[model samples]
Target: MSNFATPETRFLIGATGSIAVTRLPEYLGALRTAFGGSYTVLMTHTATNFLSPHAVGLSAERVIAREAPEDWPTDKPSRLAADHDIVLVLPATANVLSAAAAGAAPNRLTTVLLATERPVLFFPHMGTAMWRNPAVRRNVAQLREDGRIVVDPVEHADRDVVTGVVATHPALREPDGVVTAVRPALAAS
Candidate 1:
């Protein structure tokens, strides 16, 4: 395998179901602008609920929404794994994190997450309560112990659209912060 030390590092984005998914276009744009690398997105079924597949396709070189192995390119995970330098799970939902920690591959995204030899980085997003759940904390610990890069969620005050009640949530970091974390991962990879 070729070293991904150049500016041409490739990224495989494993997008999950999270309200934070609404920021994908901007996040993808920032990643491209900062690294000038190729990006391919693998979307979960739930992800479609928040954003259209077409929207993700517009920002990535390829967008794969298939769950079945036959739906993927030839040789499946090997081909996809070899095509990227890193696997990024942006807006990683608690469910996905637990599955990953348990080494479950129920879907295409988790399949790649399990198969990839490249570094896997997770950016978690959820309410503060869920983020602080004991089970969730244990899962996050397991992921880190297994050598995955799990970015801690930044606290953000989100105001309810209808009630105007502002409450703090564990949110995805700013695009620049994400890029900062990715840079070192790329270098180490």
Candidate 2:
């Protein structure tokens, strides 16, 4: 038996195009400090544009971000979903939100969202108006109905002379010092 408790959190960090991408290091650092021994991070291609896979690798034991067809599983839906404890989408773009809600998997990130059996957490980041758009609202409503956890977005003044919202997860809340040892249960509250 080991003296240290291994956390069961296998986090798939999906990123879409959003200004919040600059904050990923803070999030990863918090997870590392809290979980210590159990945390995996996977990134989306769009996300890699903002941060390097090498940087992400510093926090996670393994980092995956390939779009090659051969990289996908032989199974119809792929098997990455089967291997993770949870899928978290940070700085989720309006486009990705629409894709996930519409069941369209155009890339690895969306594909994982479509296939994962565990809890899916989405942190939407976009302009306030886009966040409130009817289509986006409907998609968000549908995702929630489908049992996905939609972390509330934080509002901030944007350089574009508008308000922007960035979705946040518990790992971004505060350092808990305890690894999230299992897939978090979905809570409506």
Regions of candidate 2 where Cα sits further than 4 Å from its true position: 1-6, 73-77, 158-189
Q: Pick the candidate with the highest TM-score.
A: 1
| Top lDDT prediction, candidate number | 1
Model 2 clashes, total count: 1
lDDT of 1 at 40: 87
Candidate 1 per-residue lDDT over residues 1-189, each given as its tens digit: 123345677889988999989899899999888788788888899998898989898998888876665776652776788888899999899999999999998887887788888899999999888999999999999999999999998989989999999999989999999988888898787
Report the lDDT of model 1 for residue 49: 87
Candidate 1 overall lDDT versus native:
0.88
Q: Tens-digit lDDT track for model 2 on 1-189?
A: 122324555566676766666676677676556444444556667778888878877766667766766855532235777766666676678888799988998877788888888777777777667878899899989888887867656544434335454443222222231124222432211
Tell me the TM-score of model 2: 0.75
**Residue pairs of candidate 2 with colliding backbone atoms:** 8-181
